[model samples]
Structures are given as C-alpha cells and as structure tokens.
Target: MAEAQKPDLGPDPSLLILDDDESFLRRLAKAMEKRGFAVDIAGSVADGKARVTTNPPAYAVIDLRLEDGNGLDVVEQLREARPDARIVVLTGYGAIATAVAAVKAGATDYLSKPADAGDVTNALLAMTEDMPPPPENPMSADRVRWEHIQRVYELCDRNVSETARRLNMHRRTLQRILAKRSPR
Candidate 1:
C-alpha cells in the first residue's frame, strides 16, 4: 500500500501589508501574492485596524507612520488578535527608540523603509530565534549623516542657522549640504 502523506502543519501564509504610499502598497501586495502569500493591504491606520479586527493575517508588514496615526497602533491590534503572528515594521525615519518600540510592540523584526518584497518575505518567514540577515544595501556613513542633518533641519522649522546650531555644524557647511541632493 502507498504511504500516507503527512498533513502540513504550518500556519497559512496569509499576509497583510499596511503602508500609506499608494504605488508602493499595490506593488508590494502583488509581489507578496506572487510569492505565495494571500495579501491584504491598507493605506491608513484606521483601515489597518479594521482589517486586523475583521481578519488578522498570519504575517504583517506595517509602516511606522501613517496619515491617520502611528503604525504601532495597528501592530498592537494585530498582536492582540494573533499573538503568534510574525510582524515586520518598516520606517523611513529609522531610529533606535522606534525600533525598540516596534519590537516591544510584538514585531518579529524591524526594517528601514524601501525594503523590497523579498526582504519582507524573508523577515516574515525567518525563525524568531535566528538573527535576520544584514541588509543587502546598508546606508553609508555619509548618507546617514546627511539624513540626520535633514531631519534636524526639518525639526528646526527649516531655519538654517538654528539647524546648524542644533547639529553643532557650521552654517555654511549646512547650507552646502542642504543645497546638494541627498547622498545614496
């Protein structure tokens, strides 16, 4: 007699992607679906929360900030709904504090923004005990510095001198950096 096949005991590969960027959200949803996940997407925290309450997925990739509110709120809801769910938080404004908050809020992993579908899939499927692979393209030190300066400039209400003072950088140097396009 033929041997019986054992049933697959893994959780279903259902994924929810929440981001405010319209093009990015649709593109990511399609890519994830092609990669064997049943994907549901939302553009705002309100929509994300409603989706979680209605049908929480086994996996989630949520942006850190949204027009409606913080994505951490959605993460909280998902965690409450599915404690075992694997959630990855994505953010353009990467910071140590927020990354810690994400993990504490039950995120399986935290990734800086512009993370591709492949990265998202890997993060969702990675073993919780294992460390995630390093990013394919980590930001350079110059780029990080530029980003920090830009953030400070914005927070200073775009006052060049104030931003320079806050960053402890020279006013002329700050102007030159601001005039130039962001480094990769």
Candidate 2:
C-alpha cells in the first residue's frame, strides 16, 4: 500500500539528500520516501553540483565533509539555482564555526549526523521564522573534540607526529586520545 502524501510544506515535494556514506544515505532516502518526498541521492560534491544546476530540488540534505570537497560548495550552488530551496547541512564532526559557515552559505538548517528522518522532516518543513529546536542528542564537548582530532589525524595521513604538530599538542597526548574509544 502507498503511504499517504505528507502534509504540504511547499509547492515542490522534490528532495535531494547528498552524502558519501552509502549505507546512511540509502537508509535516509528510504525513510524520507516514506514521508512523501520524491528523493534523489548523490554521493559526491560534483554529482550534487551537477544535479543542483540541472534540476534543483525543493529540499536538500548535504553532508559537511566529503571525499571531493566541503558540502558547503554544493549548498551554495543549490541556493543559487533554487533560491527558496530548504537545505540542511549534516556533519558527524559538527562545530560552531562550520555551523555558522553553513548558515552563511545559505543553508536553511544544520544537523549533526545520525539524524533520523523525523528530525530531517521537522527541519525541512519548519516555518520560515521559527528557531529550530536543539538537536535530540547533541554531541558532548569531549565527543566533538575527539572527532575533530580524528579528522585532523586522518587529514595528516594518520601520522601521529604530523597530526600533533598541526594541532600544536604533544605527540603522546594525541596518541592517548587516538587509542581511547570515542566519547558518547
């Protein structure tokens, strides 16, 4: 049986969800489909940019970091292509600076990764002047710090010394953080 049409949030029901994580993208697409979006999925910045220019959706969910480039590039292009489109930036390593940047680049909202379809829907359909509610499970400060460290480490090709040098921290301290499990 087909699910009923979701409540009208806009004239267009077309939604685009872009992410490099294949499994998460697929799962979110499925859930959003159930919620009545005509979903399109893209796995890279280039593909997303192309899609935006050719056929921009009314709503978009883009990841912050991708293999090719920052997702903010896509957000800017989509905003240019469809000025009224609702775009949400999703990132696993969320930060205050990046959140502000996403907004500045024309994103309608920003969400941390592992967000459920319900949360995405609420954001996509929110009133124009409404202030978004806080995330259901915002990352702890320790978790955010750990994720940032891991990101820098990976960017430095997983070289502890280089990562430490770039972060301006001792090598041993970086090692200890890397060895420990991620904080909740």
Cα RMSD, each candidate: 4.8, 2.7
lDDT of 2 by residue, 52-88 (tens): 9889999999999999999999999999999999999
- Give TM per candidate: 0.90, 0.84
Q: What lDDT does the true structure give each of the candidates? A: 0.87, 0.90
lDDT of 1 by residue, 1-184 (tens): 1123322216687788999999999999998777777889999999999999999999999999899899999999999999999999998877788899999999999988678877777788789889878778888888888877877788899999999998888999999999999888
Model 1 off-target regions past 4 Å? 1-9
State the number of backbone clashes in model 2: 0
What lDDT is reached at residue 32 by model 2?
92
